[model samples]
Target: MTALIEAESVKRYYSNASWLQRLLFLGGSEIQAVDGVTLRIEKGEIVGLVGESGCGKTTLGWLLAGLEQPTEGAVRFKGRSLGNIDAETRKKVQLLFQYPRESLNPRHNVRTILSYPIRKMGHTATADITARIHSLLEAVGLSARYADRYSFQLSGGELQRVALARTLALEPEFIVCDEPTSAVDMNVKVQILKLLSDISREKGISLLFISHDLSAVRFIADRICVMYLGKIVEQAPAQQLFDHPCHPYTMALLDAIADIDPNAIRKASLHGQPPSPMAPPAGCRFHPRCAYTEQVGTICWERGPALQPLSTDHLVRCFLYPEVSQDPDRKQ
Candidate 1:
C-alpha cells in the first residue's frame, strides 16, 4: 500500500507555563511532547503506538491528524506537507480523542453532533445527512434510536460509540485513535477494539492507534512502535516484538503485562518515574530506569544510541544491540 502519512523527525514542544504565566512574563522550561520522532503509516494499516503517559504518543497523533502543529520537523500526508494542506484536505485525517464524554458536546444530541462535521465539510445535503448518521450509528453497533439522546444520558460505552460514529461521519481516510478504549469497561474495551479492527479491514482506512495497553495493541495492530521520553525506542511487528524483544525498555514493557494464566510469574522490573522530559538525561532517556544497564556502559550515558535495525523491519535503540551500537550507519 501507499504511504498515507509520514512524520519526518517530528518534534512538538509546549511551554511549561500557563498563558497567565507567559502574560506575566514568567520563565518556564518547555515540555518536549514529541521530540525528534520519525514515523510512517501506510494505507489500509493499523500501527499501534504504545508508551507510558506523557511519552508523546498523543502529541504525535495530533501532529499526524493535523490537530496540533509541530514545534519543529514536518508531517506529510500522501507526500504533501501537512502545513501546506488546507482544512478540507486535512480532514481526510481525523483524531479520536481518549475521553468520549469530554469529546462530545453536552447540549447536542448524537444526531446533531454527528451531523455538524458532515455539514461543516459541506459534504451532504439535509436528506442524505440523516441517513448517514443512522448508518454511522449502526456501524458502531448502536441503534438509530440513540441519535436523539444527549451525551449525558448515554453510558460510557454508548458515548464512545457515538464518538466513533462522529469520526466516521466524515469518512476520513486516516484516523489517530488516542486510547480509544482506555475509558471504557473491560468487556466494552474488547468490543470497541474488535469494532475498530473490523472497521479498518472493512473500509480500508489507515489508523495510528495510540495507547499504553500493550495487550490491546497486540490484539489489534499490524505493527507496533514503542515510545519513551518522546523518542521511538523500538518498532517491530507485534508478535515478533513480544517473542524477541531487543531493547531493555521493550522487555520491561512485556513483563509488565499480565498473561493469560494468573499463575504466571509477574514482576515489575522497571522503577522510578521517567525523568522529566524538559531535562532528559544526556544519553539514552531510558538508561536511568533500565535494569540491564550496568556501570561499565560509558556510551549509554555519554552519547545517545541510534535506532538500529536488527532486521529489515525490526528496529531498536540501545547500546546493547551491537548491530546499531557497533555500526553507526544502520538506520530503521
Candidate 2:
C-alpha cells in the first residue's frame, strides 16, 4: 500500500542574505534546515521524530504539514503531491504547533476558537457549529463548560487540549504534532501523551510526533527517527531503537533520558554542540561528537555514509556498519 504521507528527498533551505545581495552576486550563506530527508508515514502510524533543538525537526514538520513548501523534492499525501492538492485535500493535513498559547487567539473564547475552523473549512450553520464545538471539547476530554472560557482561563494542559480540539475541528487525517507536550508539567505531559495515543488509535490519525524528549516519543511513537543537523541519522521500530540504537547520536539521545550514574558505562556521551546548519560538517554531521570516530577511522570524516539497514527494519548512517548494502536514499 502507498504511504499516507511521504517526504521524498525533501530539502528546505533559507538564505541568510537579502535578495538584493544575491542579485548583485554577493556571497551569502544558505541554511539547510532540512537536507535531503526521505520519510514515510503509513496510515494510522505515529512516527516520532527525535532530535535536539535546531536539528530541523519543526522545519520538516512544517514542510510535511504543507504550512511551508520545500525548496526541492515533494511532500505527497496518499499518492498525490501536496502542491497539486486542492484546498479541500489540504485540510486533511494539519499542524499542531509547539506552543498552544501562541496558536490560540487570546481574544477568542473557546466556542469562537473552535467554531472558526468549522465555519471556514466548510459551511456550517450557527447551531451545528455550537454542537460540533461541544463534541470536539468532549473528544479532547474538555467539558462543555469550557466553551465560554478564554485561553487565559485554561491551564497549560487545558490550553493544549483546546488547540488539539481546534485541529480536530478540521477533521484531519494526518497531523504534524510539533512538540505538543513541551510546555506542560510532568503530570500534564503524561496526560497529553495518553490523549494523543488514544486519539490516534481511535481516530486512525497518522501523526508525525516531533519532539526532543526521548521518553515521551518512546511512549507514543510506533517508529522512531533520530535526526542530527538537518538529516535523519537513524530510524527504527521504537522498541528496537531504544533497545539497540546503532547510530552514536541515537545512543546519546537515549542516554540523556537515563538516570545519571557516574559508574555507568554509557554507550555514547555527546560532547560539544551540533554544528551550524549554515555550514554543516563535511562528512557525517554527528562525526565531531561521535565516540566511534577513532575506531571507524577516516571514512567517518572523509564521506557521509548512506542510511543502510542494520537489520530488516533498522537503518543507521554510520561507517561502522561496513557490511550493510549501498542504497543512499531508499525508503523503507
Give the top-scoring candidate (TM-score). Answer: 2
TM-score, prediction 1? 0.91
Candidate 1 has an lDDT of 0.87
- Model 1, 168: alpha-carbon shift in Å? 0.9
Q: How does model 2 fare in lDDT?
A: 0.90
Where is model 1 more than 4 Å wrong at Cα? Answer: 17-27, 120-124, 259-268, 324-332
| Per-residue lDDT of model 1, residues 1-332, tens digit only | 43789998888988878788899999589888888888888988899999999888988898998889988888999899999897777788888889999999999999889988878767578788888888889999998899899999999889888998898877888999999999988999999999999999999999899999998999999999999999999999888998998888888899977678977765436798988889888888888888767843767778787887899889888888674344433332
Candidate 2's residue-wise lDDT over 289-311, tens digit each?
88999999997778788887788
Looking at candidate 1, what is the lDDT of residue 104?
A: 96
> Which parts of model 2 are misplaced by more than 4 Å?
121-123, 260-262, 323-332
Which 10 consecutive positions of candidate 2 have the poorest summed lDDT?
A: 323-332
